[model samples]
Target: MRIAFVHRRGGDDEAVLGQAAALGRAGHDVHLVAADADDLRRTPGYATARRTVTVTTGHGGDPVAALRALRPDVVHVHHVSADPGRSWVADWTGPLVATLHDHHPPCASAGLHRDGRYGGSRGARLPLAWASRGGTADDPLLRRADRLIVLSETSRARYTRAGVAPERLALVPHFVPDGTRGAMRPEPVWVYAGRLAQEQGITELLRRWPAGQRLDVFGGGPRERECRAAAPDSVTFRGVVEHAGLVRRLGRYQGLVLPGRFDDGLPLVYSEALAAGLPVLAFDGSPTARTVRAEGTGTVASWDASLPAALRAASLVFPTLRAHCRARYEETYGETQWVTGTERLYAAVVRAGAREFA
Candidate 1:
């Protein structure tokens, strides 16, 4: 089958590249159509894709024309805008599938975090929800999708409440490549790797980080410098490291600390940590914490007033969770399972679309 995958930019670009490579290896002719060439180059798997195509659509280029010219059997879109007036879905034809990386069509902020938690205090979220309203279960653009892929059950439920048709949603967890599974550090040094934004809870983590354990911070974002300046001497800001190097460093940590106070659908860093046999430290109620508890790969701390106490408590049991963490990775996040499940989804959607057209 000829498949074309599209993404606007960022980490989603790397995810699509991974999918394209896996599908290509499975004997499918896969093509990647993205908006960012620099991001494509940074991703290690992009080189393995059968073909890579970049579109200037976001600026002034015609993505519809590029996609039309390719004529793929299936068009799988990832991380693209869903605003009714700006969406590319209306301009394209064929079996259309979308991976909802976040709550875009429902919540304008996409993080679904507004008033100190997921789905803001009624006052804040109502306006954004009103602006991006998809209009019931029969939303035109969303309904047009043959299938909607999400990273977790948490995401599927949230999108449903936000108005996407439940029938169109499917839960497909994110995948991370196998990493260097080194032994956990004997002394319980921790690491926080990802964007340094407020929604990520970096500020809160730094403020409340237990002085007993040392933390190495990785990745660069808007708040990197501010967080670094305010952080304690025990915290070391390593800045941005390549994906491969980040995973290697993750392997040596006792656990990955994600103090994010928002509703992140599911960040790839969660998968990366587990792949390296590192347990996760996330707040309860967030998708990351839910997955960790469900899989028994880590501990979940309360996001409210008890966070510091929870953090200290999680530190004590971190070593015991290592084996469960790596084993869970093999069962759920391995590349082979991801590829096979995705191939089935693609074929099923294509067949259903063909029947409908006929």
Candidate 2:
């Protein structure tokens, strides 16, 4: 089967590509399309088609043009908010699958971190999130898509609540690559990965970071400078790294510091940390964090009013956290399970003709 995977300018390149890589290796001739060239180059075996469009618009013709040439059996699109690339799905005769990587369609800012959290509060900040956006989910362009791929059951529930046909929704979680690094050192070092974006809660983490333990921050984003300035002397900033480097570099840390107060489905890094046999220090209220705890993967902070104590406790539980983290990674975020679940969704999509059938 021939497949066409389309993603926008920026995102987790390794994760997005890893999701498609298994399909390619399974004998599918995969052609990847992205606004940026670098994002596609990292994924092996993908015939990349670069789309050049500075602004987000429903009319970008690059994706449609690329689809025309590939004659793919399936077109999987990521980050619909950046560029729904609805044009390709609009005219395509094949199945057009849009992955709900973020809550972009109904909410703007893609990640949905509107006024404060990543859930992007509704009301005033909602419109602001979509202000300069070229198009939104309610647009006729997105409504024409053949299917919607959501990474979590919760996200799929949102799509259902938003009136998307139940048949159109499939929960296809992202896959984390195997990161074989040196054994975790016996030390009290905490690490943070992913972009230092607003909703990520990195700024809040740094502001309230405990004084003693070594905190290594790895990632670069709009909030980098502010986070750095506010970080305690114990915090060390390690800018963004390639996928391999990240896993190896982050492995030494006692655990991953993920004080995510926002919701953008799930950060692939959390799973990566777990896959690396490292625990996580996620916020107590996060939906994903709850999932992790329920699965016995990581520990969650219970301090709503006492964050300092929570951080201190997280530091102490580092040993047990690391064990549980690896356990959860294998049981849930493991590559085998991810590939199986994703392949099942792809096959289901291929067999179904319309949303009702899906």
Candidate 3:
């Protein structure tokens, strides 16, 4: 299949690149259409793609003319917000599929965190209310897709409640390449890799950090200084680490700490940790926590006094969970599964012909 992947140049660039690489590996002719030409040539996917095109414009250069020239069998959009005016989806009338990478349209903040809490004013529950408050743009672009790819059941439910048809929504979680390089024994320490922001529950993680427990935090953000000050001596702030470097070092840690308080679908870090045979310690009420509980790949605890005890218990069971974590990643979050599922969706959409919701 000739697949043309479109995305705006931003945060989800790595994920988009990964998907393009996976499809390319599967013997499909994959092309990339990026909104901005800047820094794309340096990315690994830039070289992996059969051909790459950039629409260096504010409103995403004439989508019809650019895409029609490619003559792709399937057009997969990694992020709809890439086009500020969203003219690309409006202009393209083909077998289009889009992945809702974050909580947009309904939750304007995109992370589902606002005002120090998760879920911004019942946006995920009451779409009409959210739309009334000048939040109307992105949802229609999602609904217009031939298939809407959601990362988790949490996301699927949120979009379903927000008026996307159940039939159109496809639950396809993100995948990361396996980074485990052998029988590397893990040290008795926990690792956290993400933005050190309040929304990520970094504040609570530092404030309620348990003594005697060792934690190494990677990545920088707004709360870095505050978190550094508040964190105990046992906690080490490793600053920013590139994704490839972090994944390479993941097998050295006993477990990954996901203290996010919001419903961020399923973070790619979760899959990365699992791929490295590392269990996860996620905070309660998150999609990652739910997966950890269901898969028994790690422990889920609330950010409170009991967190210390929870960590201790998780450590005790960590030895037994390592193999299970790796197995879970292979079964659910591996690239083969993602590519197979994506290919199936693309084939189905192509057969169904070009159809759009009213």
Candidate 4:
């Protein structure tokens, strides 16, 4: 079968590349059409695509024509929305599978975070973001898809609450490539490996990070400069590193700190950390936190008065959790499961025809 995988940006580019390579290895012809070549070059296995096309916009005649020229068996789309000028893939026939990586359609902030917290009022910013040239809700596009894939149960609940049919949503975890499992460091050292944004609560973590604890921050974002400037001596900013490089670095850390306050779907960083045999430290009740607690892969607590104590407690169990983290990744979020689940979904979508719900 021939498949055309479409994505506008790089957020889930790694996963797309993994799926494409998996499909190719399974003898299915796969084509990747993206807006950037840099994203494609970042990952190792993207060369598996039978063809990789670079497009300016999905709505443009060039992208649509390129896709149409392929005559794909099924078109798997990620992060395509009808937001004005960014409206890529207006309307395509046949089986269309869309993955809702976040809460972008129902809530403009995507993670439903605003004013430095989750589910707060976006206030004036909401309307402005919506009215902007590149602003459009994906509800309509999601409704049109033959199948809708979500990364976690939290995401499914959020979308279902926003009026997407539960039947249309499938819970699929992100793929984590196997990584070198490292021995837990004797010293209690942790790393925060994600964007330094307001919703992520990195600022709060930096402010509250215990004096004795050592934290090495990774990834660069809009708030990088501010964070680095305000961060204490215990905190070191490593800026952005390549994905493989980040995984290699993860092997050296005793624990991974995900200070995010939002309900993240299966976070790639969390999975990568676990794959590298590191337990996670996250806020209580958030998706990653819940998984950590449930799987005994790490500890969770409120970021307020309870965080410092939680950090100390997690460090004690770090070695035990390290084994579970590696085992959990192998059993659940690893490449084999992702490829199998994705291929099954693609086959189901193609067989069911594009069913429209009223």
lDDT digits (tens) for residues 193-235 of candidate 2? 8778777778988888777868888878788889989998999
Deviation of model 2 at 293, angstroms: 2.5
Model 3, TM vs. native: 0.87
Candidate lDDT scores, in order, read 0.71, 0.65, 0.76, 0.70
Off by over 4 Å in 4: 35-64, 83-91, 111-138, 181-187, 354-358
lDDT accuracy of residue 306 in candidate 2 = 68
**Model 2, residue pairs in steric clash:** 112-120, 114-120, 118-262
Better of 1 and 3 by lDDT: 3
Better-scoring candidate (lDDT), 2 or 4: 4
Tens-digit lDDT string for candidate 1 (33-115): 66665556756665655353333233322356666777788888775543542355666768888877664445445635322
The TM-score values for the models, in the order shown, are 0.82, 0.77, 0.87, 0.82
Where does candidate 1 stray beyond 4 Å?
35-45, 50-69, 82-88, 91-93, 111-140, 181-186, 303-312, 355-358
In terms of lDDT, the best-performing candidate is 3
Return the lDDT, model 4, position 162.
Answer: 65
lDDT of 3 by residue, 232-263 (tens): 99999899867778898998998899988877
| lDDT of model 1 at position 29 | 72
Pairs of colliding residues, candidate 4: 58-88, 59-88
